[model samples]
Target chain A: MLEARNLSVRYGSLTILDNVSFAVGDKQWVMIVGPNGAGKSTVVNAVSRGAPYTGQILLDGKDIRKYKSTELARKIGVLAQDTPVGYSFSVEEVVGLGRYAYSGGMLSSKSSGDAEFVERALELTGLKELRRQSILTLSGGEKQRTFLAQVLAQDPELLILDEPTNHLDLVFQKQTFALIKNWIEETGRSVISVVHDLSLAKAYGTHALLMHRGRLVASGEIPDVLTRENLTSVYDMDVHDWMRKMLSQWEDGQSGNLPV
Target chain B: MKKREGFSLVTYLLFTLAVLVTLIFCVCAGSVSVPVKETVSLIWRAILGAELPQSTAKAIILNVRLPRVICVGFVGASLSICGAAMQGLLRNPLADGTTLGVSSGASIGAILAIAFGVSIPGIEGGGTVVMAIVFAFLALMIILSLAYKLDYTLSTNTIILIGVIFTMFAGSIISLLVTFAGDHVKSIMFWTMGSLSGSSYGNAVTIAAAFAVCAAVLLSCARELNAFAISEDNARNIGVNVRRVKLIVLIAVSALIGVSVSIGGTIGFVGLVIPHMTRMITGPNHKKLLPASIFAGAVFLMLADLVSRVILSPLELPIGVVTSFIGSITFVYIFYSSRKGRG
Candidate 1:
């Protein structure tokens, strides 16, 4: 279990995240959704030690801050929306780098049995053919998968995704999410994702943490946390009615005429 | 683009063969320009017995050319390794001693030592080497820190601009020292121009040992260097101690550059050109790139040194001038190809 107890983050005198508390249970795919300033990414950054925060982040009842960065890396893997290509490393080479922590200390350029993980990651992400291709030459979706393959090679129990499919086109977006869903379901691993699309969150999340202006507005089962009142209150708009109206356009029962 | 995954054994063999050929060719074709057959037999005879019917050709080959060639070879390898590591670490192709200000910064100690050697007294011999290494690393840290402080990303423009500024600042200090030295100014100015002349086996062995240790440290960091290519945050996420790896790489690369500069005096373009060309062949994998740079750099500088010695016949051109001429052409080609690739 990963629990955040009264976690808060501040930059200078301005508060970014305020006393937010939540827990991710086994096999849970929790989605954090809110407006632009919701501190959703901050929550992920705080756990990753990218940002300093107050209170405690407990991974299996131990304070996360106490864990070394590499030790912590073995527990949490990140797949961000856009990963820049710095050079022309081939897909496999980039994926293999995820095995860095597993290397046999310093001065011994050896790793014990990591090829299996890399191979499996490559196969799972459907990048076996592109393994030899330079990452810089790959298309955006392909590049994202290469990074996903890298994270898969890392083999963390808890996957953290920040707008993982936000920039992808329709087919790639579905492909990416389906892959994530399969990885979570097949491996029984959990995920903490910060997503902008409510429909995606509603379709895939097992639990939901709703936030607004840096505070936890609500949290619990997806259906409960995403109720019309909770969403409307936090968003300051009629989110449910608006979503259904948008959904009506694609529904099977929709009339083939303008709404006039 | 279709690229081979790892550098094949064929490439390594070709490079090794090329180094051997170049070494012999360089040794033979100098001011005297001996034939390949004669150069080989002379080397063979020298190895067989220390004492021979000593001739001027033998003396020039054994006492002069051989040591200088070996020293220049190691110096080339050291500079190239440093370049490759820095380029990988910074994730920028144009990053090296000149752009990063390390070459000029590290020159401070060497310039001081030459301008005021007897005054410092006790630690002239050993202290010069240490001071160069220290300044090289310090310049790197200060430049990186200032760039990062200015902009979180350490953008290319910021780094290059800071490097140029740092070079000017170091140049001013060097100028002030030159003004005060009066008589020593000529010697200090010549050394700053950079050359591989006056090399002895003593200097060659010292450079060879430093190259071995420093290259080993950098080679060990091949994986970390690969990680750093992605980005610092990503490297950390993948379990690399980014800070530690950065420190280790900087220190090792700095030492490599420092040792080369102290002995060879800031030969440019070897570091910039060799590693980049190696990367194109090795596909940016540091595991292959670093080793390949060793061969490529050794051969490149050896060739440059040959040109410096022979291009003007009896009156030698500065090795730095030869490298700069070649480096400019290579750099332009690299820039054009890279931009074209991106486009």
Candidate 2:
């Protein structure tokens, strides 16, 4: 379980996230949803100890700050929203980088076990066929899957994903959610994701946290936090009826009718 | 996986062969050309501590050409390795050892030593070397801190721009010093233009040792450097201590550049050209890139030194001119090709 208590992040004079708190229990998929610049990513970043915060973030009842860099990396693997890789690395090599913490972070420190993890990750993410292909040659969906495979290879207890489906198409997005669901079923790992797709968030997330203007607007079960009134006010739009129709459309097996 | 393995193996073999051949070629072809027959045996005898022939040949081969060639090899390798590290650390393909104003800073330090006979007491050329290292690190630190303040991140563009500004500032100071230098101006010019005429056996050994130590430290962090090549945030999230890696790389590179500049006087473009050239052969993996750059750089510079020596036969060309010539040509080619690829 991961817990954040009154977390606040500021960049000099500007407050990025203010007094936000949320907790996710074991194997729970908690989706944090809000409009752009609502500090949803900041919440994920603060919990992962990627950002300095005023309040404490506890991982399994221990402050995450107390953990070593490598130790924290082993426990919590993060896949950022916009991981723009500049160099042309092979898909397999990128995935194998996930084993850095266990392998001592050296060029020759990888063991046979690390190789096995990479292979399994590639297979699980359906990237086995493209293992040797240059990542620069990958499509947007394939690249997203490549990074997801990398995170899976990390084998962390907690997975923090920022906009996990940003570059994905409809099919890859569904596959990504299915893979996360399967990972939770098998490993019982907790996941905290910043998601823009409310329908996917509501359909897949066990819990939902709504944010607005660097503050937590609501939290709890998906239905409670993603209510029509909450969605209308936080997004400042007439999204309630549209969201309801979209959710019903998804449930009715008419996913194509929903907005991307 | 198999292709990458085979490619690296072939590159290693090629670079090794090239270095050996270039070294032999460099030892043989000089103004006082050692006989082709005597060259191999002379090198072998020198290596085995056998008495060299009692002739001017021994002095030229052992005392002059050997040290100078070895020094050039080490300096070339040092520059190339530093360049690779800098490019990775800054996440900029255009970055090289001198990109952070190390060369200009070292020029100022060298000018001070030449102009006022400023020496560091114990070590020969220590004053220039120490001052060079200090100024290089100072310039780099300022750029890093300024970039950090600008966006709370060490933005690559900000660092590059600031480094260019610092380079111009150092240039103006060097020009001022040259105006007052008068008699020592030619020597200062030669120092900035770079030459191996001042190299000795001791300097060669010192530079080689520095290169080995710095290369080992850098290679140890190759995995982290690879992660950094992707992105800093990605590197941190994957458990790399980005700051520690950055600090170690900067210090090691500055030290390497410092020692090389003190010994060889700002050999231009060996750092920039060799890495891009090696990167074309070996991919961008620092693991392979660092070593490949080292060997390829050694070969490239040995060949350049050969050109510097034999181009005019009697009057030697400055090594810096040769390198910059080669470097600018390669830079233009790389730039054009990359732009073409993008379009």
lDDT tens readout by residue for model 1, B1-343: 2243346898889988998898888888888977788777888888897566567777878888988999989999899989899888888787888778898877887778666672335533555677778888888989999999998777666887898899889889888888988887876676566888888887788789889998999988888888887777788788887878888889888887887888888787788999988887777888888999999999999999999999899999878898878887987787687668778
lDDT tens digits, residue span A1-260, model 2: 78889899999999999998788899799999999999998888787667788988888899998987778889999988767776777898889888888876455677557877888788888888898888878878788888888888899999999887787676667767777877888888988889888988887799999999899999998989998899989988877677656664334342221111
As for model 1, its CA RMSD to the true structure in angstroms is 4.6
- Comparing only chain B with the true structure, the TM-scores of all models are 0.92, 0.90
Question: For residue B158, what is the lDDT in candidate 1?
Answer: 84
State the DockQ of every prediction. Answer: 0.51, 0.58
Q: With candidate 2 superimposed using the best TM-score fit, by how many Å does residue B319's alpha carbon deviate from the native? A: 0.8
What TM-score do all the candidates reach, one by one? 0.93, 0.93
The best candidate by DockQ is 2
Instruction: Give each candidate's fraction of reference contacts reproduced.
Output: 0.78, 0.63
Model 2: DockQ against the native?
Answer: 0.58
